[model samples]
Target: MSEQSSQGDDDPGEPLRLSVIVPVWQEAATIQATLQHLASIREAGHQVIVVDGGSDDGTPQLAEPRCDRVLSSGGRGRACQMNAGAEVATGNVLLFLHADTRLPGSTLAALKRFHTSRNAWGRFNVRLSGKRPLFRVIEWFMNRRSWLTGIATGDQALFVRRPVFEALRGFREIPLMEDVELSARLRLVSRPFCVTDPVVTDSRRWEQQGAWRTIFLMWRLRWRYWRGESPESLANAYRSDVRNAQEP
Candidate 1:
C-alpha cells in the first residue's frame, strides 16, 4: 500500500507495477526452481530480477533464461546482493524474495488488493520447510509479531515501491537484518500489511544444525542484535553451512 504519489509522476506511460528481486550466492541447486517459479509469476504481471553474488556453481547461467535480468552482485552478503539487484530493476514495486522461498500464485493479486484496500505496505505470512508443529508455532508467532510490530524479514518476502526503495537507498548491506533494517524504514513510512496466505521458506540452515538448537541460536542472536550487538558478532554466531538437499 502506498500514499498514491500521483501514480508515477515520472512515467506517465508506465503504470506502477511489481518487481521481485531474489539475491543468491551459490544456490545453483535451488536457483533453477526458484527462477521457474518466478517465471510463472509473470502471468500476474510481476517482473522478477535475480542478482547472483558470485556463485561459482553456474547459478547465474541457470537463472538467465527465466529472469528478466540477471546481474552480478557486489558481494556475497544478502543485503549487498539484494541492493545490487534493486539498482537494475525497472518495476515500480520491488519484492525481495529468498531463493528457497515459494510464493503463492495469488501473491501479486493480494498485493493489488492490499494496495487498493488501505494505504499501507507489508509482507506475507511465513510457512516453514517441514510440517513440524513446533515450526508452525514459530511461523505463527513470527507472523503475529510482524503484524503487531510491522517488522518483516527477507525470508518473509518484502515488497515496496521502487521510488520509496531508492529514496531509502535500499538495503544496508549488512550481513544480518538487512531485511530488519529495511522493514523498520518501511514501517516508519507506512504500516506493513500481511497477505492472508503463506510463503514456504526452506529451513536448510535448521536442518544443517539441529532444529531446536538453530531456533534457540536464532532467538538468542536476534535478541542480542536488538540489544545493540554488532553485525559481525551475529555473523560469527550464524551457521553458514549449506548442506541441505535444496541448497547448492
Candidate 2:
C-alpha cells in the first residue's frame, strides 16, 4: 500500500464513471426506498452495488432488482461489506453510501468536478433529516469540522478514486471508527475535495437516543479515540450506550 504510487495520475480527460457501493445489514424496511432513490444515478449509467451482510430480512432480494449487482458479504461489519463491494466495482471512482442517506440531485455534477480536480478522494456535506434547530447546528459543526480537518465520516458519503482506495487497501476491519481511520490515512495522501452539495442522512439515531445525549456520547467516544483508545472497547461502549438508551 504505497501512497506514493502514480495511480492517481489516470487521464483526467476520460469521463468519470461512479460506482455507488451501499453496505447493509437487516435493512429490509428501508433498503428498497434507498435503492429506488438512486434510480436517477443508475439511469445516468452509473453503477450501483448493494453488499448485504447476511441480512435475513430479504434485503438482498429487494435490492437485487434495483441495482446493478447485489453481493452477500457472508458476515456483518460495514468495513468488510464495503471492501467487498469495491472489489467488484468497475468504475474509476467509488462512493460509499449509507443505507439511510440520500444524495442530492447535484451529486453527479459534484463528482464530475472532483474527478477533474487534483484531489483523489472527497466527501459531500451532510444534512440530518430532522426539522429541529439542534439538528441544523449539529450538521453545521460536522461539515465545518470535516472541512477543517480533512477527515470524513461515512454519513458524509465518502468517495475516492479506485486506485487511491486500492492503495490504501480499503478500510481497516475495525469494530468502530473505520471511516475516521481511513480518512486520516487518506488525508496524508491528498486533501479531500469537500463538496458543498449536501447528502441528507437519517437522524434516527439522534432521535432514538435523544439528540443531546447522542451528541455527548459521540463527542466522548471521539475524544477517547483521539487519545488512542482501542476501537473494540469504544465499540462495546457505544453498543452499551445505545442499548441503555433504548431501554424503556
Candidate 3:
C-alpha cells in the first residue's frame, strides 16, 4: 500500500495523535497478535504502520489488513525499517515499537500526559513476559537504568515528536545500537519523559539462551559499544553468540 500523502497537522493546540510504527522481518507468528493488541489505539483514532524488511514469509500480507500502512523497507535492519515507516507517518508523534512488545493498557493516557508535558521524547518502562523471579530483577534493572541514564531500548517503546525525530534525521541506519545512538542525540533535546507503566516484551530470547547468559551477553555488547567498538563488529559478535547459543 502507498503511504498517506498528507502529513498530519502539528498544531500545538490540537490533541496529539500517535502513529505507532512497527518494523518486522520473519515475524508472521507474532505479527497478528501484536497488531491485535493495538486495536484499542487504532479505535481511539491513532495510526499504525508496519514496515517489512523483505520477509519471505507472509508477514506483510498478514500485517496489511491490521495496520493503516504496510511499506516495504526494501532492505533489512530495524533502523532502516523504522526510518521507512517514520517517513510516511502522518501523526505528530511517532512511536517505534518492537513486534514482540505490547504497550501498557494505559498507553493513551500516558501519552496524553507526555504530550501536555514539556518534553520532546520519551520511552515506556519494560517488563519481560516470563513469570520467573529473575525476569522481575531484569525488569527492575532495565527500567532503573533507563531512568538514570535516559537511554532507551526499542523494547521500551520509544516515542518522539515528529519534528524532533525529523531534526535527528530518524534512527541511524547502523547494524546495531541504533536505539542507544538515537537516545544519546535525543537527550540533547530533553530528558526523556519516562512513563511508569511498562511494555511487555517477549522473553523468548532469554528463555532460549538462558537468562543469565543473555544478560551478560547484552552487558558485554553495551560495554564494547561504549568503548567505541564498530557496530558492524558488534553485530557480528551478537549474531555469532546467538548462533552458538542455539546450537544443541
What's the TM-score of every candidate structure? Answer: 0.87, 0.95, 0.95
Using lDDT, rank the candidates from best to worst: 2, 3, 1
Q: For residues 1-248, could you state the per-residue lDDT of candidate 1 as single tens digits?
A: 22222121233344547888888889888888888877767766668888988889999998888888888875788888888888878787788899999998777667665445433457888888876677887888888888777888877888886777889898887888778888888788877767758888997766666677777777788798889988887886664432332355
Model 3 lDDT per residue over 86-183, tens place: 99999999999999999988999888777777778999889999999999999999988988898999999999999999988999999999999999
What global local distance difference test value does model 2 have? 0.92
**Candidates' RMSD to native:** 4.7, 4.3, 5.9
Candidate 2's TM-score reads: 0.95
Better of 1 and 2 by TM-score: 2
Cα RMSD of predicted structure 1:
4.7
The lDDT of each candidate is 0.77, 0.92, 0.91
Q: Backbone clash tally for model 1?
A: 2
Candidate 2 segments exceeding 4 Å error: 1-12
lDDT of 2 by residue, 1-248 (tens): 01111234545477999999999999999999999899999999999999999989899999999999999988899999999999999999999999999999888977877787778798888999999999999999998899889899999999999999999999999989999999999999888887777899999999999999999999999999999999999999999999999999
What's the lDDT for residue 2 in model 2? 10
